[model samples]
Target: IENSGDLIRAINLNGGSTMEWLVDRGGGQQIITVTPRFDQDAGRWLVGILTEMVGAHTERRSNPPWVALRDSFVNTWELLVLVKQGMSGAFSQGSAPQLSGPIGIAQIAGEFTREGGLAGWLTITILLSINLAILNILPIPMLDGGRLVFVMLEWVRRGKRVPPEREGLVHLIGFAVLIGLIVVISANDVLRLIDGRSFLGG
Candidate 1:
């Protein structure tokens, strides 16, 4: 009964490809034949459904106090999972970790403002802190990980150090590229802000 809505169809499977469902949702129990749909781009069979269930009584107005801590921990863990997938190139076709600059940041902040204003800002801040900490651990030049790489190299060579000038040059080049990427992403963000559409190539 909780799953009833505007009468979205339901599916029943018995550990095989065969399927059945109930379409009429007026508290009737008549079952009907349902079929999964296939799409070309996504290349998957979708059993179209809205699975969310709401309470029979009035919904709770606010969360319990303990929910705050639980939510924070759960959200942080979810971010960690995404970060791991991102590092593994799960989100990218070309193996580059996608970067968004200040403009994207501002748009996301604006979204949070709509959700709960001050509370949303606090959540964004915590999320950003965790993301930055994870990014800082990557072995990219001009970052903490880059500096650690140099130290490791020296250790491998038993104190024979590479010239500071060469290492400095590499860092300078990497920093310039990073700045260029930020500029491009920021420009995209500004365009998105102006037109209210993203550069996500929709």
Candidate 2:
């Protein structure tokens, strides 16, 4: 294929069918047969080849403040959409969810800071902040979304409120569950670091 996008599209279109290809190398023609495999990361089928633009430029360009802000919003919206799609497919058939905990976050931050310097650090910081905001707003107890849910429920009940003891109990249980999840995720992170394998076989 000419480019990576075209290659991916071609493979996806081909689905599970075997493909035959003609290759030109060193003034000789060769035939190759291959089958596409499903890739969880891209959520698509691939033939395990890397392709790039014919004449891609690596130089960075500066944009005006307004244009930069607009692009930032656009990128954030795209990320949100991607996250929504991932969440929807997280539990789908033959799909496994991958998560990073505090240790993983630290490793990622350190790697970015060392390899990409200031730009990478700032980018990761912003992403983490946005992730925290998203998590806080999820409809789970002991979070802002949980409080909002209670408010919504009270409004629907004509100002009637849930008992203080019950609300406290629910929040406590939620907090415990949250802590347990963090611990489990952290342990998984440690295991991945030790073995270089994903928790759910990638």
Candidate 3:
């Protein structure tokens, strides 16, 4: 309930009336009601509440809970690295495996289900998640981690930030590279579909 109030305040600050109303209604139902005059004030109140809750939760989870979490993350990273190396090596031996567009992925999913049962489909989903995570972490502009890198650098530099022009150029180059990769992968996927053979096998 305390966390919810903070979330509602943040939502109100962002010009969201529905959440504000809900919060108001919820507060009214309680014995002590604290009404905020401005949206920004409500947002700050909510953020403060959230900070307290998060701090408490973190303190509580600091020992044993975090150990399990750390182990899970390590296992996930190990799995990702293994799968990435295996797939890359397999593709590098010959032509790379094709990239799939939305339609292609659906087709592949249906085909996998028909050919190899539920286990094969599950494997595909897991592989796709790993691939997505790796791709997002690539040192390219316009990605979450890429932007986050810039943010870290800016913080380190204190006064200096990456110039907008340079940032724009980097993002443009990254976009072009990504597009070229997509095109090449899509072509390979199309060829594999037509020829009925894995591109890497050929």
TM-score of each: 0.62, 0.73, 0.50
Note the residue pairs that clash in candidate 1: none
Q: Local error of candidate 1 at 187, Å? A: 1.2
* Steric overlap count per candidate: 0, 0, 1
The root-mean-square deviation over C-alpha atoms between each candidate and the true structure, in angstroms, is 7.8, 6.4, 22.1
Candidate 1 regions exceeding 4 Å error are 1-75, 86-98, 198-202
- Most accurate candidate by lDDT: 2
The TM-score obtained by model 2 is 0.73
> Once model 1 is optimally superposed onto the true structure by TM-score, how far is the C-alpha of residue 48 displaced, in angstroms?
6.4
What lDDT tens digits, residue by residue, belong to model 1 across residues 5-97? 323222211111456654557876878665644322322234565466555554435778899789778767866865554444323333345
Candidate 2, position 60, lDDT: 75
What does candidate 2's lDDT look like per residue over 110-170, in tens digits?
A: 7777767998799789888888888899889999988888889999999999998998898
